[model samples]
Target chain A: MTQHTTGAYDEELRDLVSRIAEMGGLAEGLVSEAVTGLARIDIARAQNVIFNDHRLDDMQRQVEERAISVIARRQPVARDLREIIAALRVSSDLERVGDLAKNIAKRVIAIDGQFHTKRLAFGVEHISEITLEQLKAVLDAYTSQDLDAAHAVRSRDDEIDAMYTSLFRELLTYMMEDPRNITFCTHLLFCAKNIERIGDHATNIAETIHFMITGEYLQEDRPKQDESSYIPAGYSSE
Target chain B: MTQHTTGAYDEELRDLVSRIAEMGGLAEGLVSEAVTGLARIDIARAQNVIFNDHRLDDMQRQVEERAISVIARRQPVARDLREIIAALRVSSDLERVGDLAKNIAKRVIAIDGQFHTKRLAFGVEHISEITLEQLKAVLDAYTSQDLDAAHAVRSRDDEIDAMYTSLFRELLTYMMEDPRNITFCTHLLFCAKNIERIGDHATNIAETIHFMITGEYLQEDRPKQDESSYIPAGYSSE
Candidate 1:
């Protein structure tokens, strides 16, 4: 009887971990599709990303519900409790990542006919590719519970921030070069910001994994190279 | 002994609720101060908003810790479970609101020396004011468990969306008007988007409250008037 009960409990936890992996996979796909749509200005591709977000949202809800139910039934403490809570945290981050991708898709649609600048999205796409890699690595680290891999994902977030800063400068330069580029450039700027935030969410998932494994919150401040927040576009610290 | 244990559990739940309330108050203050700083271009006020965000973050962490501890101790199900989960959700929404406010404050500092257009902050300020009110009402409804009030807050999110749409148009016009205005207007556009996101968080909290009271997720689509997502600023849809 005890073996049966333990088997059922293990199955529940395993299901939750798998669901989170599914969310992570779908979120990565949406983000990749969204950024590609922006780069190519393909409204149909962007729409697919937009529509796929609902399935991601549904999966997130299911994960949260399952996590809460496990907590209630198992009365889990310590490690079990941490795993359930981490599932909740990771799922929420994945949901936000999906929403951010949808935001980029919306911009792609918004800028569809404007077609004023095609080269502009290259920077946005490049940053997104890096963010997607971080996301995939963190999700893998989370499922495998690899501490070093999680730390690696956490350490790499600053590079994405630095890349986003440079992208911000590129978009700003494009806007200032001609008034006509302002509309499309602004959308690309937000697309880049959305990708940067996806990187942040990946870092968040990494921290959740770290805390789950170590039972200690990562204490140090995340190094941020996003000085774009401090420096206005036209200004030069040089 | 049973009574004493029950009292302790109740105390833990009470502490979680009060901590969430404290976080809500701090988030509201941060939003108001951040927007006011933008209006007046007050660097000190903006800096204060940025620093005080740490307090809000700490409060959220504390709330989550207490909520999880309660779930572990009480093994709460049904209504008690809902209340605990609601606290977790509300704290998260409030934390994101604080982050959004800090984003606005950062933009204020970024645009500080430009002084390109004092009038531009007016529209941004107006939209933020409405969002703040929505946040306040939603937090109050969440604490009081007022379903009607939550619905009211949910209903009004559309108005905030409308206000954000107009503000987006105004900022777009300012940017397209001159290259000089592009830099400052870009900052303002992000600030406005941040405020709009705060409103979305408020609506999210309201939905959480509704779920807590009714034990059912709100099923209707949130009416969004944010047509700016589909319209490029320089192009006339007509």
Candidate 2:
């Protein structure tokens, strides 16, 4: 009788984990679409990201419902219970990360095709690419339950933030140099900030993974490292 | 035997709701203090908000952990399960609201006392007061499971958004009028946007409450109204 119950519980937990991974995949897709939409300034793609947000919201609900159902039916203890709870929190964060990405895309659309002019200088594009890579890594870390990868994602957040701050200062200079640039530069600044925030949400997912493993929160706060990289459009920060 | 088991399940579910209420109070306090810190441009208070963010994060984890534990131990179904999931989602939203508020305070300190010169004609003092009240109302609506109160909160969010939009336009004008105002106006704009985001988070909680009672998501995405002047300074919005 004991063996039968334990076997049933293991199967249920595995089912729960599988459902979580499926939800994570959907979430990662939303972030990717939203960012790609922003980069290409594709209003259709951006609108697609906005419309698809509801699907993620629905998936979040489904994931939580499944987790709760499994918990109630299976009565998991210790590690399995923590894993399900982490999945629940992760889905929530992932949903918000999707929302933030949508916000960026919306801003991209609202700016009315202005980013196309005067091109990005001072590594904005590189920073965005790195932020996207970091987001992908953290999602990978969570779905795979990798603490080392999670830690690496956490460490990289500061670099994205610093790059963003440098971008902010540069944009401010543009707005200052030509008041006509206010509308466009400010929009880009907010877009960069949105990408930075997406990185923070990714860091959040990693921290949750660390907590699930260690049963403790990671202690270090992400730092704000500033940079003064203002050469020409052709010059790289390196 | 069935009667006794159901009765025990009911009591455990009640306990989950009560714990969620407790966490809600803590989150509300964090948002209140964070905005108050921004109003004063108090660096120490701002730092405190950031430092205490972990507590909000921990509380969120605790809420989900306990909710899941109850589910495992009790095996609740239907409404009982829905209530627990609602608590989980609401707590996550509250934590995000706290993070947004802390971000506002961080912007406050980043401005470093130059804020007074560029104060929006709309006034931070006024917006701060309304925002705190909105936070409180949303928490009350959640804990009490009052859908009417929740709807009312939802209605007010549009107002908050409109106020933030107005502030956004004003800040653009200020930044265009004088380059020196860029840093100061940017910080204030961030603070305004943070407050606006809190209103959205509060609305999310209200929607969750509505969902818990009805099992349906909010269908209408109404235009955000202007709820900023609902209460005169030194009075109440009610």
Candidate 3:
């Protein structure tokens, strides 16, 4: 049965759901703030993002401990078991997302005052916004147990990958154009990579949701649109 | 009390330990081949690394499924529960290690015919070998339940971080010195990052071992040595 015999067990499950939601919110805010920090070069905001990640990490640990405790004590099976598993998976994803955000924030500090290229920052921000939306939607899907929303998030992952490809190309071109831009562009490229990875984590959460609902792993290969990996050394689109 | 009464439960636990060892071996081989491929610019070898990652993925899936099945069916408690949990955590870390290796291999393919600088490749290989050894030691610890070896792996992680920071500087200097070095150095930089991340995953596995044995999360903040984040734009060691 989905409902446990004891009220205490049900209460524990509810706590997991809420904890995941909290973690999601924290992770999302970190991503948004990190990108904002990078785009605006706000050192304090980026440092704040860095400082705040430990909270997410702690919450993730709490979620895992709670889930394991509930499993051993309650012997949950079927949907209840899946719910616990999903909580574990999603919290881990959020923790990784937090790390990605922190990576971005770290680069924000690394490039502080050295960044004069305003135009290059916009593409990074644009991709960040899309990834932020994707992360938000997937987390919402988890709270509502909405399968369709999760699938949509999974399908849209390629969009983030595509944007990251273009951003990678753009940064490399800027670095090539002027030797002075090399250091900043390299840092920006990493920031874009961090953002792109956040999008992958969103897709991972979406897959976790799929597993929770359908009781099967999402079997289709991820439609990866980022071909920057195979881009020619010559930078020719041909 | 350590031994379960049922023959099947003990069998399941043994299977999990063996699977983890198997996954560890596969992950280690992939990392070795990827670095070798990177250093030698061996496209065929890199392609093999990329192709072999799916096997690691499949084994990780089996480890998780089996762990979950045993948990639900056996309702293991205490040490048994921790053992199963360790399997899950280790498999996940190994899967990530596989991904990092595959990423390096992908870059190997990306820069296929263009790579000429030999020195850049050597530093990467040096770091990779150290990280690979750490991974092997950690996996052996996991298999033998040797807490001491795990602790050793955990402590040496900063060495990899230091190497990565220096490599980061080296790549940037090369890029600045000659624009022709930009693309190759950029790719090398990412390869170094992937290796550094593999080190982190090894450290993560070490922490998992600590948790498995002591039944408490390692609460101390990791000794992070990679201060590449704060390295100045001017590339001066000062």
Candidate 4:
């Protein structure tokens, strides 16, 4: 291959990476805004998050097409091929992150001023803060191909899972306390689950980053502690 | 390209398709068993579903690696390239379907013989039946590259959404009637949701099939009718 050909190939790869970066940024912003809107009960901001998801979708389509084109043109083997596959997988994960965020935004509109509980809102905010941080760190790991950072994000997901389990218990107690609270708490529970799923997506990207660097899957089982739905022994029905 | 070269390429493509088909079959079976386990409260069947999910994950990894290897060796362009990309996307969707089924299986163990309402179980069975049908139809469409069949699957998602909304309302009513039913009904709600999300994944595959055949996205917005979360107007708090 000529020097000029190699230069053009490198340039195309850079463009693909930049597009993924842009999509990642959009996804991160959407999750943050959706959680904020939920916390503040701000309909307009939630609406904004919902409306902006189309952009992430469009960017994902673009990245996919460009990646395919590069593969066809370059016929890149080994590491280059792995990198392209990683980009494709990461883009899909980010697009899903956008959809989960949109689901949370939709819940905000659904709740619609029926009830407000400060402590419950605090629980959601705390979980969202940790999830957002994990997403940011994972995206950075992908950009830098930092294996250790990616492993760190993967290890830390149990924190989000544990938090989600506690929130689930609290919401269930809230609902059991009063029938009127049932509808409101149900929506909050879904919102919290969406956040938890977003954390899972972040962990997925972390694994993808690890694979991209090593061409091997993370050998250990994903650490998970979420057991909120489990029923305890000897709990008698009223 | 020589006839031998073309023959080898076709063989490789066939192998890839067959792997996807195998994964699809496994995912379909898992959904069926998980829902049946829930309906019958059979712990063994539910545990079987949980155990089977790892196979789908392994199949997905194999599909991805094979697809990347094919692209590197063949540099397939245009339709061939699209087909490989479609395979990757479909495998991912099937893997997620497997995860959602595992989630239902987990919920089966969680409810733990506390309460078993026949009517609620019937509702879940009904929704799972429809979603399983959709998955079957979409997989068939992908295998045959039948655009019309794919579009039909995409159009039928609204039916699942409507069913989910009714189930949500029914479950809430049960919870309100007896506080003792709260724990059972909440777990049922999550199970119903996992089925609804499986429907969404089927729709996603339908769209992917359409793209593989036509190289264009379905232009219309996805039809949605889930409004159970919406707070009703003029509802006074008790």
lDDT of 4: 0.84
Please provide, for model 4 over A89-146, each residue's C-alpha lDDT reduced to its tens digit, 9 standing for 90 to 100.
Answer: 8998999999889988888887666665646667888999999999999999988889
Which scores higher on TM-score, 2 or 3?
3
Model 2, A138-234: lDDT tens digits are 8788767899999999898888878887787777677666666666666666667777877887788888899888877677455643322111111
lDDT of 2 by residue, B199-231 (tens): 788888888889888877686455643332121
Report how closely model 4 matches the true complex, as a DockQ value: 0.47
> If scored against the real structure, what TM-score would every candidate get?
0.95, 0.82, 0.97, 0.94
DockQ of each candidate, alpha-carbon based: 0.59, 0.22, 0.62, 0.47
Q: Is the docking of candidate 4 incorrect, acceptable, medium or high quality?
A: acceptable
Q: Summing lDDT over every window of 10 consecutive residues in candidate 4 chain A, give the lowest-scoring window.
A: A229-238
**Which scores better on TM-score, 2 or 4?**
4
Docking quality of model 2: it rates as incorrect
Better of 1 and 3 by lDDT: 3
RMSD after Cα superposition, model 1: 2.7
Which tens-of-lDDT digit does each residue in B47-152 have in candidate 1?
9998989898788887888888888778888777888998999898888899888988898899887746788779988888889899889888877879999999
Best by TM-score: 3
The local lDDT score (0 to 100) that residue A43 gets in candidate 3 is 95
Q: lDDT at A76 for candidate 1?
A: 80
Q: What docking grade does candidate 1 earn?
A: medium
